[model samples]
Target: MANPYQPIEAQILKTIDETPTIRTFVLKPEQDVPFLAGQFVELTVPGHGEAPFTPSSSHFERETIEVTIMKVGRATTALFGLKAGDSVGIRGPYGQRYPLESFEGKDIYLVGGGVGLAPLRSLFLSLVHEIDKYRRVFLRYGARTPEEIVYKYLIPQWEKLKKVDIDLSVDVGDKSWVRKVGVVTCLMDDIPCDETSSIAVVCGPPVMMKFVTFKLVDAGFKPENIYLSMETNMSCGLGQCGHCRLGPYFTCKDGPVLTWEQIKDIPEPFV
Candidate 1:
């Protein structure tokens, strides 16, 4: 039987605090929500309108969806205030996804800072399930401070995953925290990568991404081999609105993820 239409609503089942300022929402959709890692969706609250968010859950499991959001904007502040039984409208599973196969059999690097870890979390979970497929996997996560780490509950277990190299850093350290103390860019010095056979995925604030890309290139990574997740003030996930458009490219349709070489020449890729 062909379904007449797809339902766009999802009921909030649970809310977990991944960090002091970040929350993960578990939503069960009226219909199955299908998507790939690195893709984002437009979440609406009826009269309050829509905002973009990337699902933190892997594509391999879609029965329940997870979206981790930082309460930095008005829409997110409202979203954070919602309870377990609340409902929100979601329009997609949209945008081009990260190219997972490109990293197969090659050394891989993930560079994330602050809330940038949200989308990459999905890719990490998916890779863990099929750990043997890649040569090496390294994760470099940086936060503004010790308390800003998002996956406090899951990071320890993730570090134990076979063949996974997890390293964390903080711009500012606290007494109780006993790990590297420096900017996320400092972690790049420790990644043992062969540019010819490695790929890097980078996600973070504009300033962070700018510097991380510089470090990766300095480390011999090709510009094209660096994948970046660029975020903007996204309104429509399907490209109906121009808010997220970057010159000739419609980020909502073409990408939230693009290889650095693909847009390096664009004067203001982020503007």
Candidate 2:
């Protein structure tokens, strides 16, 4: 068996600045790193260490992978210095993926905040790839301010697709912003799908997820039907590392994707 700890060399094909603190790197690995939506990868920044990140690109596209990262710590700061053509290491495509099969024939509601939108982009793209299988796709996203919104370039394109609807908001807005001004949860007030038959996927800051969960529950979304991307301190891509333990499960192994019902009883799950 191949050593799971070993990382394959990948070249940075390009980089796109999404915000002052966020950027997207397009990489071409020496070998294909196939992963389903919601799975994550450990990105190594040469001399610096590696950190876990979920790919922001569609899984259907095999030639290259895109990872959207926020420059918050040592590894990510080191990554910010590298440019196109620079080399990095990639390990994993780790953790459980979003269960796409279960979503078929049901309306899908995606709620994301700030860079949390990264992982959801992969899920959105996958759904769009086979648009006929699903009933409809509703995207509700919010950023702290207009400037911090990632994927600014693609949101319009996504909104134009048939069967997809998008609602955007910002905690604070400037003159150029014309969208709703409030938290992402505000967008949920006028949910266009049947709460009983739809699936809601959420990924964002812990605080945001916590409140969003409360709002969804209040809105009548079944706990099992609410999926969350809980990418906590996943130091290792394998289960042997105990850093990411949440009760009996390891985030890196059993999930980065877990249903709200599975974690609702865990004390401070959003924390």
**Number of clashes in every candidate structure?**
0, 0
Position 156, candidate 1: lDDT: 94
TM-score of 2: 0.98
User: Candidate 2 — number of clashing residue pairs?
Assistant: 0
For residues 25-55, write the lDDT of model 1, one tens digit per residue.
9998888878888788878765565788878
TM-score of each: 0.94, 0.98
178-206: candidate 2 lDDT, tens digit per residue: 99999998898878889987999999999
The weakest ten consecutive residues by lDDT in model 1 span 1-10
* Most accurate candidate by TM-score: 2
The TM-score that candidate 1 achieves is 0.94
lDDT of 2 at 178: 91
